[model samples]
Target: MPYALPLPLAPSWWSRLLARVPVRERRPRLRVVAAPHGGGTAPPTLTELYLARRLDMVRLALFLVDDLPTAEDVVQDAFAAVCRAYGTSLDGLQDPGAYLHTAVVNAARSVLRRRRTARAYVPPHPGAGAPVDEGLLLAEEHRDVLDALAELTRRQREVLVLRYWSELTEEQIARTLGLSRGTVKSTASRALDALERKLAKRTETGR
Candidate 1:
């Protein structure tokens, strides 16, 4: 059940991202974690956290890294880092979910860094092993958006994904990305504008 996600419950921002397409009541095919209830229950163990959030984190990493296999690797490395540092019980961590989120983000950055430094990286050609991941059962419209997203700068994509997909607040995104609140705000603003322009151009060009 490693590929299992709860259901399609997209946030409002996701709809906005697909506004260019005809509104069909479609939701983003990603797992959105519910807010934690207020109580004194013990924090989730590392295994519990992985079982609950692995697919969701994979989707997040997909947005950052732009492919399924690499995204899965990013998530695996993130969890491995968490286990190495905190062990299975996650005893000393107050918010394991947030820590995991930050780990995934950081791991994705490392992947992008390595990709940039590599001398002979070949971009994935169209129609070659792109539509194969069952865990990433994204629609054609969603793929269009992803194509446009790939045009954005890595920082812009990071800010937009964390802000819209992860539903993180400005302060949380700033802390996760190690930028100021002001920087996060400006980055998200610019990212959204840029995404809209890219999507719009896609619509106009009909490509």
Candidate 2:
């Protein structure tokens, strides 16, 4: 067995507990390496599957996070998790793509949550004047999109990313986020409506 050696023991409470305990997934390599897809004697393996889908994870992640670098990091992390979960048999997993998609979405959500927690409110002392913006702001549509995205609530952001970037239907988005289909639809509608307003303002002000 891939787990511990099958010890000959009579059926009992202790044995049942040991059997039910899950196997801990090993930490993936720092850099991912997929198994060989085509070889003389060997067959298609999980490693090859991993490499094939790595690019897809990156693309799917970008629409959710809206930052290419961050998205790549997220994909890499997700891949690590997937590889860690890889079993020698690859049984019971009817759809690896579904598994990867769910993992990436969860990882992205975790990243966003950590960012928010890191931003816990800190009051400024009397002498600490508001920090000055050293003129890094650029005038562009991408910037406008960034601003609009930042303004959205977290759920709105996720819904928009799934609907537009991932091209998922409301039912799919809802299933991914663990929300109702109606909620997903409502969130996307609100997010898009707000983004349109922001774009309109930018157009009128020439900013």
Candidate 3:
């Protein structure tokens, strides 16, 4: 059986966790092997998929986890798992893109699970700076937005980012997130309303 990559939250709440965090220095790019999409006869190879989709997948994972290294790790692990499960020939799979999308989402959930577990047991040391320091790295406006974003439920965050930033249609998002179209639509509506309220509150308080 294919490993089920269930979302940590319900489909209606497939949100992300954004924190005020420092951006890491850019890492060297992954070397991509060029391969043409197999014509009517064959499916595109995994190498082709990686070369084409790695950046986009990384961005998706980054949006979810809010950390570049963790996002990259999530993508790397997803690819490695697929390679292990299917070898180089992905021809038989119905939708490799969807499979990879599920993999990245599952991997990101695993990272967050571990992070939450670690935080439960480990207390911060005295005099330690915030795990994420926004003031030094982000402008006031950016910080306010992110701070407001952080207040949202994980599923709400996910819905908004996928809807707006990723520019996925409701049906596409439903498919990617294993949600019903109705659920996606309602969640996005509520999330938008909530985000607007949060931003407005912040603005009013700042003034």
Candidate 4:
């Protein structure tokens, strides 16, 4: 086996619908074996770690990114990256869980950069059978906020999204983006200020 990235596995009707493109016939170079800290031995390999954490990651990415297809793309990319770095202790990845989490977050930001028209947050779908009020989530006020976020520059939007949505510390965001903590804080505060101004303008206009 060549240790390639795992194929996306979706257990949803939507997934089947979207995945009609046909899975390739190629075999994986990397195969995930069951973890055995006490069950056996050998630290979890890249694939094993990914399989253990895939569902949560997929869910988080979908929520953060709104678009299901894009979420899969982001995760797949991140997984491939993790695999690529598995050589030589994988950047001291002593904590695979943390590494994957960070990778997913960074991937989500990358997706936002590509789909520049997307809002700051994607509202959850009521149709997905998850019990949440989609209408309330997508209310006029919230819509205005997302629209305003979309209007801002990508860097500002990214900093805010990572800080607020991903719940990443300033230091984490800085490391992920290869930026200084001061820069991350400055961008986030500036973004928040701009969003506030826009929201105030919108509220005043409505009144």
**Winning model by TM-score:** 1
Question: 1-207 in candidate 3: lDDT tens per residue?
Answer: 211223333222222222323433343343333446743444457887787678777767866776666778999999987788777777565666778877887788899889889889999555442235323433343545556666788777777767754557788778878899999889988987887787778768892
For candidate 2, list the clashing residue pairs, or say none.
34-47, 35-47, 35-48
What's the CA error at residue 204 for candidate 2, in Å?
A: 2.1
Candidate 4's residue-wise lDDT over 96-201, tens digit each? Answer: 6557767887888887766554444665444443224433223232445555666677677666655554456788778767789999989877877787787678
Q: Which candidate gets the maximum lDDT versus the true structure?
A: 1
Instruction: Looking at model 1, report the run of 10 residues with the lowest lDDT sum.
Output: 1-10
**Could you tell me every candidate's TM-score relative to the true structure?**
0.77, 0.61, 0.68, 0.52
Tell me the whole-model lDDT of each prediction, alpha carbons only.
0.75, 0.59, 0.67, 0.59
Q: So what's the TM-score on candidate 4?
A: 0.52
> What is candidate 3's local distance difference test score?
0.67
Off by over 4 Å in 2: 1-45, 121-141
In terms of lDDT, the poorest run of 10 residues in model 2 is: 130-139
Error of 4 at 141 (Å): 8.0
